[model samples]
Target: MTLDTDPGVAPQEEKLEMAADLTAAKEVAATDIPPELVAQSFGGYLRAWMARIRSGDSGVLPVLLGLIGITIVFEIISPNNVFLNTGNLVNLFQQSAVFMVLGMAEIFVLLLGEIDLSVGYVGAVGGAIAIQLVQPVTINLPWWLAIAFALVVCALIGAGMGFLITRLRLPSFVVTLAGYLIFNGVLLIILLLGPFSGYPTLCTSSCSGAQNNSHIIYQLMWGTIDPTVSWIGLAVIVALFGGSMWWRDSKRRRSGLVAPPPSLTFLKIALIAVIGVVLLLICNANRGRGVVQVVGVPWVIPIVLALLVVWMVLLERTRFGRYVYAVGGNPEAARRAGVNVNRVRTLAFALCSATAGIAGLLYAANQGGLSNNVNGGQLVLYAVAAAVIGGTSLFGGRGRALHGVLGGLVIGAIYNGLYLLGLAAQYQFIATGIVLLVAVTVDALSRRGAATGARA
Candidate 1:
């Protein structure tokens, strides 16, 4: 082409040659870049998790350890006793059900850096409404319809509170506290009037009313699926859990993303399987009173587990969940990012109330009926304590539904153990208060340590 004699042509040829060289160099550099490292074995994954814990992201480790310690202590104190008996264990599950659900309800709001003090009373109101509707002395509505009505009422109440808090810029604490009193009053009024009027005069060890144990409510609290059914259900659940974990890790690896080692994944599945089997064995044992044998997992156990799974998916897998974490982490930034912060918060409140309504149903079932004497104030406190104890941060933005389950178990164990040891009510209160204090202190220290580490 005689480029040396043509000035423009020579320049164009040189530029093209340079561009080709640069592209080749870039390709070489890209090839030289190292792949992201991930855990290649069980030991490596364990070390990674330990490192995370040391960095103040311990997750459920503390609570789990605490649970073990509590269990051991109780076992030692009640040597060769019913404290660890199958029947007692079943009772523990039933006792913890309401707390677990309520803690879950609290987590929705807590993760958003908000609190709903009224949830306990809200639950009472919901239960009362449902019970009345289904009672023969009242409208005698269908049990399903009664449940729907109660849940709807609770949701509306929650939405109203959310509106006031969001649109009116009211403090959640103050607003919810007010709601607590109002709802409690409403519950009392409901109990005192109409079908519930006869409830005041009747009293028993388990409940206050003769008509408390309606067919559906009684079944919910005391009924059990067949042992064969329980075993089958647990197996399916375990298989699903293992499969999901394996699939998630395999997908990540295929995408060239960080993934846990296959060995570690296997270990996780094994642990879950072990726990499930242990629980199943305990529940399947015959824990009889007199000649009557009680066996199989309580219906409430499956219900709580289902709720946990649903809430976990909602918080971890969805865009809305991300928005919740974002809003709690930094409201201003989230708003700037075009997230509808108010709407998220409002929805969180509504969800919290809905969960509380479910808890209320459980509570009523547990008691054989809804009563005016329901100590909602105490229950609310327990809910907060359970959530905090389970490793949810009081500061917000970092938590999971599993936290409630763990925390509720801790509370249940404590109460169950104390009862077995013949400890007084006052001791139970003191123990719970102390545990809550310790949890909060640990949470604060961990948060501070994390902040300092980040700076370092």
Candidate 2:
């Protein structure tokens, strides 16, 4: 059969069109056209599509930018040059590390839509035990051994709470309440057994600013890292932050999905590096009164960063993490999906309690020692505030370890800035309360928005 073509169409043009059609067919067969090419081909027309995909997302970018803005604004306005000083800057991390741990602990129960009113006391009891185990008047165990023992004890306690809640079908509220009372008693017993030894304060003076009259546990926990941070330590942090972003983006690309722009990713890396270097430089800036220069990264800094990474990986990369979200989203559906809901919940509790124990120890260290006056209640409230203020939800199923860090940073900034401003304790407390309330309200509103979008 003779074929007649349009008079205006050349043979070359017909061949080019045929080639394009075949390429389109191949793309349809494979699916997922190269994102970069798709973007380029669509040009600005993909803006609506990109926006749709990123809708309701709560990654770290907004928080980071907001923090930068706040820091700059505060620096510009504050008198006495306190906001830009190196000492105060390093102090920010020192201040926030405890809350980071506490926030992380809360994330577990929060994810499960449960609450742990006892974590603070549980951690307090653990720290008390640690000190008692190592005090000259008590067991006199090695410091390292004491810390390990404290962690294990706390983990078991958390497990016990989980068991009580799951096996007995008791609400988390009731179980944790009983735990709070029991642990508070335990704290008293430990304190009485070994009265605040001077050794702790003496040990922590070199590490955290904690007073020596507190328990030796705190001194040992936060007192080891000097203000003089090392280049090696800074390098490790840079590597970690870089590695995380690279791996995450690579995985996303391998999964045949669009990745964030390379420029955006590199900008994140640069921001982290800048923060690390600035932190190191500030800590190393001779701000001490004595002839001896106190500089070097605090041990707590790396510890908190490490914990942040571990928790982030657990939440973002693991099947357990997805299960956590699933349980939060629809517990009944998760159960029907054959998820080991109780097991996951129990494990989460154990992890949360153990982390809290670690944080308590750090808190004690920052003080250079634990004291009978250690306000476990107030500390727990601050921790919760840090988490929510950083953007973790009180209602659950909407948080990340990074949020804890951000939230903790915000809390720390408030404390440091307010202290510099010579604000009273009452004012500080009120300000923190307000910030936390606002954060929770925002979280609830965000959840509602997500629901609305899903329905629509």
Q: Pick the candidate with the highest lDDT.
A: 1
Residues 182-215 of candidate 1: C-alpha lDDT, one tens digit per residue:
9999998877767456352211235434344355
> Best candidate, TM-score-wise?
1
Give the poorly placed runs of model 1, Cα more than 4 Å off: 1-36, 198-213
- Model 2: worst 10 consecutive residues (lDDT sum): 1-10
Instruction: Return the clash pairs for model 1, or none.
Output: none
The lDDT per prediction is 0.81, 0.70
lDDT of 2 by residue, 1-456 (tens): 000101111122345556777778866466554353433222232353344334443434345555676588668766876787876777777887787788888788887888888888888777777766765544677777888999999999999999888888899988988887888887777767645543333243343323223335554334434433467766876798688877886686577555544444565677778877776677667766588665666667778878888888898789988888788767888999999888888888898899899887877677655556766677678777767766677776777777778877877777777777778788778777877776777677666765665554
Judged by whole-model lDDT over C-alpha atoms, candidate 2 comes out at: 0.70
Clashes of 2: 20
